[model samples]
Target: MMEELEKLMEEAASLAGIYSQEWTNRNPSDPGMTILENLSALHLVQRESAAQVTEHARISLLKLAGFVPLEPENARLAVELAQKGPFSFPRHQKFYVNNVCFETEEEVRAMQGRLLGVYVKGQDEFREIKELKEGVPMNARPFGSEPLTGDEVYFLFDELPCGRKVGVQLYAEVKTSGTRNPFSEEEPVDFARMRWSCLTSCGYEDIVCQDETHGFLQSGKIILWIDTDRLVKEQVGARKGYMLCCRIVETAYDRAPELVAVHGPLFSLIQRDTQSFSMSFGGREDIRIQPVFPEENFFFVYVREQGCGDYIRYAEHAGPGSEEVQGRYYEKRLMEDGRLQICFLDRQRRYLPAEEENAVIVICCNREMMLHREMGVLGGWENQKFDLPPGGCADAKVLCIGVRYAKAEGSTCCTFFRPGTEKRDGVFYTYEEDSGQICIHDAGPYTGCNIFLSDYALSVWDAGNIRFGNVLTSAGGNAGVRVRNPVRGRKGRAKESFQDIRKRFLQDMMQPVLAVTEKDYKELALQTPGLCIRKVSAYFEEKRNQICVAVMAGTEAAFPRLPLLYRRQIERYLDKRKILTAKVSIKDPTYIRVDVYVTVSVIDREKWDIKKVRQEIAEELDDRRNEREIGQIISFDSLSGRIRACPGTGHILELKTIPAGVPGRFIRPGTDIPIPPDAACYPGDIVIREE
Candidate 1:
């Protein structure tokens, strides 16, 4: 700036008083030299202005004494909830705070999980449903008056599996009247609530386990939601003249609410009937706050009670985020969503007396109100001020949670005032978008207190009482309950994430051999993309002169039932690679968990960490991940090696195992103990001691 000013002054030497002699003179002592003095004064002002300008460009750089520049962001998700009959919500739901989504991908059946429902009933609500069990009926009575001899019943199951739903065909003989016979072979008994209709039609009924009950309906088709990962095979008899094909519908059309946050407690809200809304303050930028980048900043959101200013902050439950890798398995990631969140509990079997009307959701975040910027000034309205809109409680019914800004009085888009547009929008709703901040939606109503909210409703209740489905009648009269094959259904495999896909592809390329022997078969299967079940094994049956292969299908979370399709794919691969004329059979392998018991003598117990020893044993024994393969042998050598590999193992004393479902003696050390041909060895109960 000084050099430019000097050059300008030199140029002004050619012009006289028009430019002023102060700028032309280099000496400050000269009487007419005010230009240089004024230039130096202006430099300080410009320098300060430039520094402020730089600070405004970066949000991370800007700071105020009591105000934080960035507001914390909330994690949002789209969630789906279901209900059945009228039931009150739990006083409190048991939730895993750090992570909110269900971890185990294992399928949950009617007998596995119970849903709570609510419906209006003349100023009163009733909890009528006690349990809803899955699976087919096992017993039934002959529906007729009969005198007959030599009657036999046979049950047959399909060898192939359906996706989830199965069409069941029932075949039974019903006579209107009957003559007498000895009721000894088939006893004659009766119950008070004799509703044969439950068995006659499964269409209107929520089929237990989404099974053959649909065939019982006899009318239009009904769909059942399969919560399992996959289905094996199920076949039922043709009962009641209607040949039922118990088939499953793999998909469904459903809508979900935007997930605002994942926190839990006994807070209540006037929920929207079909939809829920989220209020985010940080993800969107504010025009009033200047110097924002074209991009938005990220924040870690935290919560506290509305009235308790200095109370302990609580963390919300979060489904896995997409932003960064987490945990020992760094493959999972989370996206950064800025919003206020409020989660609630769904059901309580214990029955709470608290009324819904008085229940309120009070939430607060460590809000960083932004109102500063550098490049351009917001609210350039001269002599005029704009206020923000009212947020939170809407009509005293809606539970409002989030920050609300004031409405603007004058023109927000232009520098000059525009007439009569009126402040039609809330402060948070309107924005000078050309500025970094983008206006989203109107501020949510104040729920008595401003806050963000949870986007889901969790159905939590007691687990033990739910044992069976609709039928509560006692067994055996003169009737025999015809049963369908107990073939379970699943939720099916989820589409792999990019990280998982990449890891799997890369891992698949790491395998270097073909499948001929058992070891080779196991390795090839484990390395194959999309099919890494717990273990894989190959065995030859000389009688059939063919190779029989099986796989422990599914991921590490829980053992998965291999669908017929996947099993077929495996067979195709193995068939293609097997020696000519050697037919191969690839099937789903059963699992026999091996319980390991050990009491090893260590020179010093302190030297050997018990936890590490157990972990090592698990790593080597557990067939799911590192050590055990699908059909690999249960090697004592590997077990001892794992124990010796522990940091503190000085020596060993004893180790034995009790095979699952089998009651025998322990397998002594040094035994080969190959896993059953159709079975995989899973790590069961472990009792470790230092002798």
Candidate 2:
């Protein structure tokens, strides 16, 4: 019976659930009815339904309550729960809406205030918003709702509007709502009072203050004036007090009071048509004082010394027309070896015999200064009324005077004067024309004997001037001095210089040999006039197969006597013909012969016409040979296969041939005989037939 009753209950509950879902889908205009119906369906099925049915029911409930479900699968139930109340859900109950096709709970909350017309006031309007503090809702009550109840108010964000202007108006209305009395209404509580309270709480007491000083403090405007002198002082202190003095000029006194007041006190002023000023300060002895002025200020100042009284007195006494103080003079006899023998006289005119013969006799004048040069006296009396001796050295030589002057009122007075160059006799005189005072300058010439004097004098005189005067002698001879003469033998024997005998010999002998050809020898001989052949020798041993040709009587005929330089030319020619060892020999009485060994090479050529080659070689040989009618050749004898030559008598000659196969046939015994067919055998080889 109990099982049947349970089945009947379950059937009824299922029917109620299906009816609820149908009602929810049908009521489109009734959002509350639709949400309640969906919730009832969820309550009927507890944990036994599929997840899809649960999700669809929750999404329908949220959408009915104005909660947008972006991820309906994940956020549908969360959006519905968030739209239900302000209470937060458990962590397990809160669904992760990221994977669902529904808006998140945060989105639902964002729509909660937006859908409810809630607005938040920004920081700018918060200063004027007397009722609102940080984290407090702008709208706590409905429009025209009851006045605020307590000192602190808790408000849900959904109670306010969303727009900024609507939020501001709502905030102002809420702040002023309590001003009307619930019993007897006085004027609304002053808005300024609320503002002051807010500002004071924000720690902006000065911002709310009505006092003028407080207004100035919060005004946000600043005024500044620079103290230029103080600034300069500060800079000076920072840089340790070094300052550059400034130059200032006042063009108009009325315009520049600072310059006009300080004129002659801090700085001096000179009134003139010009716009320049010159500064002169400190004593004349102070060298630190510098003059400062514009370029146009042309002026001069007389610098005076304080302790120059003694100098002035001495100067006055030393000037012109004072007195002719006699100078000390003496003559001493000196020997050639530089020994002083005797002093002739003293100023007293008494003979002073030498206590020490070599002693130097120094004569010092009575006056402090003495006249040595003639110009010293004449240069001092330019305008002074002084008498000079007529026959003095000053009359013989010209004098130059240098004078320094000082302006007195509009006139000039000579302050100092001196003679320039000393006279020929070496005397100097100086004077002061204004004082008529005379001084006898030093009588002795400035010798520069002392080291101190030499250095001081060099500083005063230039090197060129000292050199011109011969005061400073050169350490070596002058560059312009002619120490060398180019002309030969004029000043001394020319043999001391090296003679170019080799070059001269080459020019005289080799030059002719190089210029003439073999065929021109006879013509050259005729042109040489008076040609005489003396003696000729083949220098085979001494000069290694060169011919020593000797001729007589004429310079042109002296071919055999030609120098080695010319012999080299003939050797070069013979070398070209492969007759390097041929030597021309001459016996006296005008007979000559050329000795050589004929190599097998000369006989082996296709053009080996021995007659033609021999003629050509003989022609070259005869060209260099001295003039001699008889010529002979001691050569290898091809006919007899021996070395032989022609022997000449006074007119007739006989042929001398050395036999073949005989030891020492042509050469003397122990001499080397050239081997035939050996390339090393030159023309002058001594050929002895092989045994």
Candidate 3:
């Protein structure tokens, strides 16, 4: 651009010189010279149509609130994650990016794999097995119909993976008897006629209940959304209830039946304004959280047989103190070990009874309900040959070998000095340019645990979770934990780039200071990490001092349900500084599922994979989502355009985009689609028929 401007100046100067020679006026004060200078300046300052558009496009409005678009990062090839069984070449796990074949990795204790196994090596042969997609319930529970008005329980799910589908097993033990309600044989309790509900956050509220027959247990699976940070900072629902709650009502029986232990997600299981009694508290008075499970800090109600009704920190139902002080009061203090210690006022208006024993406690904690889980050894690793904590975990993404480390005080240089080594492993200078590309596959281990080693050797260590000192191995070597395979690459950055700073500066010209309004809500919701907001509907419920919100993540065939964790994050953010009279509630949108039908001509039939072309068209149309363009309908021309871009697409032979018969004649041969507020389209919702 500068070079072009310089060339234009030269041309302008040349023309001016010619004019001066003819007019005999070459002075700087000449009117012609002044005209040339002003024209050159204008040319430098002005932008043409294409340049204007390019500049506008480069000013990314989407990068605000620390949003960094993620680019596909390539990992260097290493040992592929293989299912435990007979491993073979031509593995089914192979995937290709940039036309290079790479093996995909998997979590352990999995049945789905490329090969099946046999123990004997004598007649060893690898064989394909049926996919065992069945899920093993990692957690389970039982409930009595006694608290039919939606009872709640709290448990620590320190290792629950967010956004993954999990098996939720729920069962109501049906009484079977010869006469005295004795079960001689097993009988299935029909949850088909029973209504059960569990409180879930964000987009999870839209999960429709599916009835299941009681075999051994009635169970179903759904994607669990856990907002890692919000789950830690805020209460789950209005009354500060359980992180997750389940409520069931037996329309099947007027009389409450025998309840069996089962686990699941239940909607409509909302608790009334009351404290929980069913969920036992597992947390100690000292709210010392594990480094990896630091967010697990909980609040509980402690009751003793001798009439000690002391509560942890929060004593909403405590009696008057010795001197007749009113209202229940409790105290909290941080101990030297960094755990929160709680005590209640005694008759003397003092904190706690000297000794604590036989405490019958009920946990009423919420995570946004326990949203985040990471690799870090808590205060102390349980006694094993290894003294390494989760912090010692080398790569939080995968299980590997090295120990976790942090830089020393006042240290600007990042050094990866291996413990017990005479030399510093190395120092990393550029974390932004070179991180996450490092991988570990397999290496020698002194403890005989097969470990993976990447070429990273040792350099940059993410210090976000690192505190105190370096994690030490049992043998007292480097305390870093390494991984067998890279489980995570670069996270989608939440911060704007340097180039985006100017855009934000310009944006601030129009709007300044965040406020409690729909505009701010929408902005904040989209800015949240791990979220993509297509649109947000924030409706204020004035009477209730509540804000009801519905959010659309994207325009795919079906709505991608928001994770509970992300939902909690939005909720917590709103609840923090919202007007004292304002309470926040998040609800999923009512989806109006519309199908898109397209027709295309095959340009290069031989090279064109018709099915693939159809898919690309579908993806392209989905990508044209603009949530702010309200009341938009599906466009025939837009669909046609996507089809035309397909590798095999010839000019349109006869294009027919369907549902065109809808009331609004808004859709043309395919320009754009209009959608109502908080609506989305998913992958399969698009239909393609080629002529």
Candidate 4:
């Protein structure tokens, strides 16, 4: 700036010299020199003003190029509340830990209703869990040996809990512990999907609140919000009650899910704080309310004007004439220091607040708040964009977004906002997920009216991952229930900022969407929705011109066999991405079992734990299966070394590896076992003896 100012002053003085010979005073003490410096500074300011782009302009340019910002995400935690006896709780019940609050996601009525019985509906027979347990163990397969699409697991409850909601939890003898890729930065996707239906008078109507079981692939819980008022009590073989049937809608299980028991009336909780306060609004056009909490955790903000029975609505854009259809709406502006200001409509827009009453303002900080409304006015600019208030991060989930527009004041003529870039006369906007901005376009007849966001959701990004025992007391402990997170919270993530979005947007432009090569097909299969896969191998058969994709269901399975549903899911995912010329087929890899027998002398009998050594050998082989890649060779030398490396290991007397079920056929001591291209290998059995 200094250099530019000096150059500008010099140019002005030279031009003056050419115009007037008497103007020879150009030194610092001369009054004319000071005037030249001031003019030069003004020129530099004008030049900067012309060249710089405002934030709104940058957002608009990005919107025109199809890049909008993203909203923040709230962290989720599974909370368990314990009481001495049976208890019931409604959704959104708050529990506090160090001033931070966590609310229940669904209503839970714990131990209120007894689980009468559990039955598996077969083609013609209904097998009761108790009857099935007579000869076998406690383990039960409620969906039968091979669960089909129409197969159902019937859970009979003695009486429906208040609110007709049942949080059914399935406990399995074999718990599934999935191991994720340590190097992966991408969020882990659920590989489990199940459909739960309640027996209503009209028949089985789908009612699923939440399922943490990963489609019954593991031992978790499923919450079903049933309409008991319309539920029909039907007899299943011998017993009858309010039956909740879990139908197999779509599955990717390697085998049938086993269960030890079915429990219920449990719900997940999220961290958030809700507050309600009142503010004075005496016909003022702009009213600012600063919340006690940080603006970043802001989830929902609502205001009810004085004497108005209903809360004033919030719109993204509202101009001269837009109040009748949208109804008493207000706008919110985010300040530079992250404070929220509530902006009301002017007298021209028909906003009249009663002088006697105080306006009620309710705000929810943290977690998901539905129907979060914000009002604004469309400036009629091409590709105009509006930012969500302070809490709107790059990963905020927008379930539904629509603009409410009213053309004339008190006029009932208004239209709903559609999503897209189509040139239509009505209001249309597109949600830029990465940028967290809404861009409005083609408002030919609705310009200068109120543009309102009727429905949206806000979350706190990664703040909800609270520690265990963080919540020591319930906000309102009327039921005398104690609460604590038994396990550490997870799945909470920080908000994706706009800077991250731009970087991702650029990187995405260069990322391949289609799966062309063998590796691409493998990756596509690995990313199949609802399934945490271990390994995938795609190989092209030269003669058949067909690409064979073999998938190994992650180590959660005892004997992994890609079921028909999983195979179909992988096939469908790859089919959409693969070229038309390429032939893609999804198949389960052949599983091979290897048995080992070892006899060794212990160096120190007192220090060696025989049982621990045996267990360590078994675990070593299992770990090898998890780490091994497709077509990777299992060396006999490596296996022996692994065994020898065990603690308190002495000299090995003899070691032999045998193919399971193949007697007398043993691989020579030093030879490596060759794995087939489309096969997965795991240890079958191991026998250790002292020499």
TM-score of each: 0.26, 0.12, 0.27, 0.48
lDDT of each: 0.34, 0.24, 0.36, 0.59
User: Which structure among the candidates has the greatest lDDT?
Assistant: 4
Q: For all the candidates, what are their Cα RMSDs to the real structure?
A: 26.2, 66.7, 23.9, 14.3
TM-score of 2: 0.12
Q: Is candidate 3 or candidate 4 better by TM-score?
A: 4
Error of 4 at 475 (Å): 5.8
Instruction: Please provide, for model 4 over 30-104, each residue's C-alpha lDDT reduced to its tens digit, 9 standing for 90 to 100.
Output: 998898888889989999998997766766776776777654445555544444435555445566666556665
Model 1, position 24: C-alpha lDDT score: 55
Return the top candidate by TM-score. 4
Please write out the lDDT profile of model 2 over residues 181-251, one tens digit for every residue.
12111211111111111111222121121211111111111111111122111121112221111111111
Flag the better candidate by TM-score, 1 or 3: 3
Tens digits of per-residue lDDT for model 3, 149-202: 333332222122223333222222223211111111222223213332333444
Steric clash count of candidate 1: 92
Q: Scored by Cα lDDT, where does model 4 land? A: 0.59
Deviation in Å, model 3, residue 93 alpha carbon: 45
